[model samples]
Target: MKNAIVTGGGGGLGKSICTELSKNGYAVAVLDLKIKDAQRTSEGLENASAYAVDVRDHSSVIEFYKNYGKAPELIVNNAGIARFNKLLDQKIKDFEDVIQTNLIGSFIFASEGVRLMIKEAKKGSIINITSIHSVSPGIGVGAYSPAKAGLASLTKLMALEWGEFGIRVNAIAPGFIDSGMSKPFFENPKIRELRGKAVPLQRLGTSEDIAKTVLYLSSDAASYVNANEIIVDGGVIHSVLMHLPRE
Candidate 1:
């Protein structure tokens, strides 16, 4: 059975990714900071286990993988957080937190996971969950936009360095995915309407929509695809930019 690791699996989008992987017959490791929640998620799956990991801590990630015994064939760096504040209002701590979790954490997990996979001589796939903000920037996203942009660049770099070892690296950039983190904003009718109107699909993205893309890139169907980003934003990027000319 192919072994896979889904970081942040205790949460909404991450949980969906784990479930999708499990449905596809892979043995999944649900890695999250909350042990109880991770275990709870694993219990509902057939061939899944739980691992508690603090993605920000490199030592924690290394130890967690070491204890898991076997190298995972797939690893999704999905743990991320965004604290919104205008550049003028942003504190140093806020910027540090974003860089630490979103960018550095991904590096730590990717490094450790790749080391294990190499030791096991397994051909593996690594998926970094980035944001459309990686390309498109906005106000009140000082740290978030840069962090994701860094991740997107890192994705390409890793793919170039690891492909010779049969390791593939790619990124999934989602646009306004409807999840617990975004539910509050979507609850505001104005925000909801604006989001719908902004996208060509006239609706916000669902976690499953993003998960399906993850499944594709992790499976053999995407074997020849590497160092690329699959955007799951329902054409929002183009819609917004297309209107810029007349403004």
Candidate 2:
């Protein structure tokens, strides 16, 4: 069976991706910092295992790959954190936290995952989870936006470097997906209404919406696809400027 590794597989979109991967006949490794959550997710699947890991630590990532005992055919860098604050209100360390998790941590996992796949001479797929903020600026998302933008660039770099090994690298840029991440913003009636009105689909996206795209990219169906960004924003991003109040 094909083996897939999904970082942040313990919750929300990551868990949904694991579920879809399992359904499509892939043996999945659920890696997360939350051991209990990871184990709970794994227990729900037929061919899934949990690895309590912190993707931010290179040593832990390397050790997890070693303990996994085999190279994975697919690696999804879905572990990320968001902290929103105006530049002046944001603490330096909080900004660093966003960069460290969303960018540096992703690099560590991708570098390690590619090493393992290369050692095994395996054909592989790597999917980096970016955000709509990667392409467009958002209010109070200073660090988060830049980190995801960097991640999108990293996705292309990996695709370029790993193509020789028959490994494909791509990214999914999700907008307003209803994970715990979006809960606070959506809780306010005005905010929720505005978000819904922003999207052409008239609703926020679900984790499953992004997961379905990830599954398709990992499968043979997307065999020739590489170094691309798939936006799952429900068309909000396209007409964002149109929604701005006229001067």
For candidate 1, the TM-score is: 0.95
* CA RMSD of each candidate after superposition: 1.6, 1.7
Deviation of model 1 at 111, angstroms? 0.6
Tell me how candidate 1 scores on lDDT: 0.90
Query: In angstroms, what RMSD does candidate 1 have relative to the true structure?
Result: 1.6
TM-score of each: 0.95, 0.95
User: What lDDT would each prediction earn against the true structure?
Assistant: 0.90, 0.90
Model 2: per-residue lDDT, tens digit, 51-112? 99998998999899889987789999999898889998998998999999989999999899
Cα lDDT of model 1 by residue, 1-247, tens digit:
8889998888878888988999999899999889887887798898999989999998899899879888789999999888899999999999999999999999999989899888896589999999999988878987999999999999999999999889999999999888846767888889999887788988999999988999999989999999998889999977855657673
